[model samples]
Target: MKQWPFYCEQECEQYNVSSIYAPYLFDTSLLFFKAVSTALDLYGGNMSFYDIVTNGTLIAQCSVGELTGATDIKCCRHQMFVYNKTPVMGRTHDCYYNIGKKEMAYIRQLRMIDHENVNKLVGFCMDGPVLLSLWRYCSRGCLIEILTNDNLNINIDGFFIYSLIKDTVEGLYAIHRSPIEIHGNLSSKNCLVDERWQVKLSDYGFPFLKAYEQPKSSSEQLWTAPELLREPEAHPTKASDIYSLSIVMADLVNKNLSFENSDYNGGADEIIYLLKSKTSRLIRPVLEPVIEDFNIGFTHLIKDMWAEEPEQRPKIDVVRKIVKEMNVGKSKNLMDHMYSLLEDYAASLEQDIQGRTKELVEEKKKADILLSRLLPKAIAEKLKSGQQIQPEHFDLVTIFFSDVVSFTVLASKCSALQVINLMNGLYTIFDSVIDEHDVYKVETIGDAYLCVSGLPERNGNMHVKEIALMSLELLKKIPDFRIDHLPNEKIRIRIGMHTGSCVAGVVGLTMPRYCLFGDTVNTASRMESNGKPSHIHMSADANKLLTEKVGGFVTKSRGEVIIKGKGVMETYWLLGKQGEALLNVDE
Candidate 1:
């Protein structure tokens, strides 16, 4: 057998006997040799030397001495006993006799030892020829024992499995987030189950002391990450720990030990070989099949953690978050019988979502139609989409208000049917002009038409341009009008435009209508009431956004004009028809 060296391989010529190791003055003395002997014995033959030192300190009062080998050592489990004494000691402790108390104190001060996840050191005391320390006990045994137990059977339900995975992840999260990385030995034995079957991570450290002496070449490379296994260049990292954890998860899912169901008596080489090759598939068959049978969302998550490239694994924090999302204890049975029920539930949910989406679309269409009829399609869309349709306050917006100028006179001369036909013909042309330039026709009062731009919704600089287009188009179509079954007659319409901001919103819940109220709206109405037939009166602010984009009308400032609600506003008159230029210019 190959010899493993200590952490510091330098040899010491002088051996120091621990003060705690002394012959008991008498068998009846509280500080007896027998108690010290038993404490040291329990630690001597242990799988982990670190566990020995710590556990010895807790159960027995003694100082620890270095152990070269078990031979010539008499500290056996049968000899250990607790003695009520001022001093304690061990006999036949030939390895080291007088280890200084100060050195043990120094070891306690190391930051790695102080970590909560690390095995805690209670205190060090002395007994005759023995040294002792304390540690937390795990009854279910180390991960090694659990994994090596061939007869071990675990039939944990799926929900319990989920919870265990989550708990393990949280434990790992704490370790990985600490200043130092804690690489858990990936085996079934280290994960100890308490009374309630809740898993508690035991063997709480990497045992740096043992690892230093353990040859890197001889270490089990199968549990290691690919990068670490392939070369000596890569040092251990948190991601490496994650890789080990994924393997543990695989074993739990399979309900088998992590050794690929090999016989328990196999040597380390045989176990390592099986683990690296065949055992690697344990996690796959267990995790993949289970998720495929239950929920497929997390199957990819399991695969990602076992990725050959360490960097591809999700960070510990992300893993915690993913595990937290899983619903544990939500399901009872783990058989294939629930498959049909789950499928039916999923189908029902999908159908519900589809129905809701369809209903929303139909509502949107109906709302859009109503909005288009009330305001223009363009303004309606802006409002429906919850865009900022600012009430421009005192800011000037061009308001275009128009009507059939000869409506009353025509009605008095013609029959009722003839009058109705004539009105429809004129309003249809007005509607076309409004649609063409994206202008909102506010409302009509008995053949009186009202439209505006840059008021309820700010058209910015384009307000006047739109009004100019609508005005020119309406004027052009007026002269060609002929009412069916009625004598041909020439009629002119007046349109007024003003630029200012006005308050606008949905009014009256009973018949919710988007209405504009403020000086801007009133002044706009006044412009049309005061304007002449075939003319478009616009405010100065309305012209700014136009930037002469339309060439049909000759525009000139009408100077300050007294208007209702607006004491006086600078207005403009759009004088008719540069037909070819107007048709060519894009609004």
Candidate 2:
């Protein structure tokens, strides 16, 4: 691009010597690239489009990168700077540049000077020996100042001295009507009210005064008009200046200056600036007059102003006309005018109702997503619909239970988020295996998961073999879990399965759940709790069913064992894939 001096000289030629001046302040000690780089990294990118001039030489510049590289861009600087030959405490916090341009200087300047129609012009440093002008700072901060200030508790009056508003408009008119439009970086900082309630526009940092051709590639083009945003960009034209002013008008009408906190903006460059430009002028009139001294309406106006399309906006003169006509002075009269002006209030109210309804639908979708994460979608949906899913009593359901070994202790080793991801990962493996077989998942209680086949509806003789195969697959897949948060723990699942008569039905009124009863469920849970990791335990009936017909598993009879409340029962361990060397079934 074109160098600084060439551009400056060109600007001087076009706007006369009064609008342009060459830098004379010089001190190499004060001119360090570190300070400039800090500023660039902080505010440099799109918002940092301005140049850092110190002394008689240009030290460095900050420019936002292209869109593709935006996310990787970290625009923060922590370099130190020397002001008044003394070290300033922190690096220049620059990210607030674009939207907070005027406010940065205005805030400090307001405290230093009391001025009407002139935002407090505090001193600014050029990252070198020389100092430049900065807009003033106000003691009470900006409009949001009193709103959020805990100690002050000052109630904001919307009237804000109409004369002050008029003066701010006059200053705006002067800036826009100038030979070259002066785009006041009109942030809350740049807007100030002296003790006398006089309003002034401060901080001319981003304004293009007089006329000068832009660089072959202009960095500011991102927020500029599309024609100016192209390569070999057009000069910063009057229309662009008007576009920026529209944003300033919007700030006044909306009360608050920044749109950063708004969720609607979504980081779209052209759209953000455009929305800021439209403000109160575009607000549905039916809703406007009813807005009391202070309410969410001001925030709503800010959103409408900065809408994506600039052409859909009203002109400044037209905006001025609306504001003037709506100056009904009295609150009751304003409310009366609200009914007759613009569209009907009922329609706007209906729109709000529709918007809320849409939001509720989205919330339900998200809740369903979260629920699906916790339980299988089929079961989760059935539960949500409030269906009485009665438990199935069957003579042949294959019940399976698996528990994460020492899950409670492992949970203590990790963060809440880490534990959740780890748990989900383990369950996901089990879920995948279950889906391959003819089985339906019951529910997960803590770290334990339950599943059944052969009722609700039965898949016949395959239920026992299917559950056994699923358990084997689960054991084979166990070691894949490697959670950084729990390095010492290897995720191991202990499984237990049973095949016999059991009554299954939905239980409870408030938290209605489908569960199995009788010895089958109790035996299955006992098998998991008592079994070793990577091993599957089965009741005598389950073993007999699998070994007699399937004939693949190596079964080891563990003799009669006492099961809670059911007395001594015979059980066997299926030790390996079927037909491999048996694990001494009688031993």
Top TM-score model: 2
* Global lDDT of each candidate: 0.57, 0.55
Compared with the true structure, the alpha-carbon lDDT of candidate 2 equals 0.55
Q: Which ten residues in a row have the lowest lDDT in candidate 2?
A: 16-25
Give Cα distance to truth, residue 7, candidate 1, Å. 76
Off by over 4 Å in 2: 1-362, 366-392, 405-425, 455-457, 485-489, 548-564, 576-587
Least accurate 10 contiguous residues by lDDT in model 1:
16-25
User: Could you give me the TM-score of model 1 versus the true structure?
Assistant: 0.34
Estimate the TM-score of every prediction.
0.34, 0.37
Q: Compared to the true structure, candidate 2 yields what TM-score?
A: 0.37
Flag regions of model 1 displaced more than 4 Å.
Answer: 1-364, 375-394, 414-421, 455-457, 539-553, 556-572, 576-587
